[model samples]
Target: MNRAALRLSARVREVLEEAARRPDRGDISTTTVIIWVAAVTGAVLIAGTIALVIAKYNGQLNNL
Candidate 1:
C-alpha cells in the first residue's frame, strides 16, 4: 500500500511538472470574450422581456 501511494505521488508530480513546462495557449481570446458578452446581453434582454410581460399581466388583472 505504501509503495502504491508513493508511485501515485510520483506520477502526479511528473504530470504537474510537465504541465508547468508546457506553453501558454489557454488564454481567453477576444472571440471568447465577445461570445460571453453576447450571451450575457441576450440573457438580460430575455429576463427583461419576461418581467415586462408579467408586469403587464398583473396590471391587467388588477384592472378587472
Candidate 2:
C-alpha cells in the first residue's frame, strides 16, 4: 500500500509540473463569446418550450 501511495504521489507531482509549464493568455475571444451566447439562447428556448407545453396541459393534468 505504501508503494502504491508513493507512485500515485509521484504521478500527481509530474502532472502538476507539466501543467505549470504551459502559458495561459487568460483572454476571452469573440468565438468564445458567440458560443456562450448560443448556448444561453438554446437553454432559454428549451425552458420556454417546456413552460408552454406545461401550460397547454395544465387543465388535463389537474383533472387527473
Q: Which stretches of candidate 1 lie over 4 Å from their true place?
A: 1-25, 59-64
Please, what are the lDDT tens digits per residue for candidate 1 over residues 1-64? 9999999999999988978898575979999999999999999999999999988899787889
RMSD of each: 5.0, 6.6
Q: Each candidate: what lDDT? A: 0.92, 0.92
Reference-based TM-score, model 1 = 0.53
lDDT of 2 by residue, 1-64 (tens): 9999999999999888876886454768899999999999999999999999999999998999
Which of the numbered candidates is closest to the native, going by highest TM-score? 2
Tell me the spans in candidate 2 whose CA falls farther than 4 Å from its real position. 1-25
Model 2 score (lDDT): 0.92
Model 2, position 7, has a per-residue lDDT of 100
Pairs in clash, predicted candidate 2 = none
